[model samples]
Target: MTVRTGDELPPLRIPITRTLIVAGALASRDYQDVHHDAEAAKEKGSPDIFMNILTTNGLVGRYITDHFGPRARLRKVAIRLGAPNYPGDEMVLTGQVTAVAEGTVEVAVTGRNGIGHHVTGKVTAELPTDGPGTGDAPGTGDAPGTGDAPGTGDGPGTGDARKRTTDSPATTDAPMTTPDTPR
Candidate 1:
């Protein structure tokens, strides 16, 4: 079950509650109390506040991985925060593929609140393909499919993307940098 282009993920609607906020924070190792306490969040600079970006993103990743199955390798992920997710607010995560290349499938992901967008996310996965989906055949699923995974060498995503594996799996886009920030 290597995911192919246009592979759709299941819908998720989770209410952003204090417990969730705390759990997300703890799961991501982000100990910022602002995410766990309303008053602390307010003192920091929030009206009602909720989980931090890292926490929100971790949940989103978990959601995708769980849906895509064990063969899924998260190759890329990008997200931007907008409206704050406060307690009692429902956050929905949805996505669809934008492109595929050499074992990689890219998807445009977004997180929205009841009223509007709270965050946007991008992710790519080197998923198991149609044949057995487990890549169970050695030289294929046994490895991360740097293209040599089993018989998928000639599979659908064989392109420049194969070269990207040498540096890192590129789980996220380039970090945002500005001229004003010191290099």
Candidate 2:
């Protein structure tokens, strides 16, 4: 689909729960105590466990990509967190297209929770100019023959590994020695 500046993306509403906060933190590999431990968060000056920045980043990316369709690739995502997204709260995400050029779309986004803004940021994404629903874009998830064998060159893999070679100094005659292993 053709996009222009001032286009508003559909708003997304998400409920914040303990499971959501913890699951999102884990999914993003953020193990900070404040993101999972309510008591620990309280001790650290927060009312309870809160969502992590990585989770917010992922959500923001999801919001933009979902609106732009599968062909969209996030070039950059910059967000700042405000109010804590604690359990029992809800977050509403909204975005607007700030600029559109060649193959890129710039979006300004805000995720607000019950207390206040949870995240505010800008996202830059590349969209296929051919229009949406064409499914010919590189990452549109509708590529042909993608369901083939994992190592098949017909898919997304490099044709054949036999054509490539490593530049390591160690030859076939020598035992591999890494930083943890002595010669």
**Residue 24 C-alpha lDDT in model 1:** 79
lDDT of 2 by residue, 51-159 (tens): 9988889889889867766545666788999998999999999999776655566789999989999999888775544432334234644354444335556222554
Q: How many clashing pairs in candidate 2?
A: 2
| TM-score of model number 1 | 0.66
CA lDDT of every candidate: 0.66, 0.73
Give the lDDT of residue 99 in candidate 1.
Answer: 63
**Model 1 residue 152 lDDT score:** 75
By summed lDDT, the worst window of 10 consecutive residues in model 1 runs over: 172-181
Please name the candidate that would achieve the greatest TM-score relative to the true structure: 2
Model 2 spans with C-alpha error above 4 angstroms: 130-183
Worst 10 residues of 2 by lDDT: 169-178
Q: Which stretches in model 1 have alpha-carbon errors above 4 Å?
A: 1-7, 130-183
- TM-scores of the models, in the given order? 0.66, 0.73
lDDT top scorer: 2
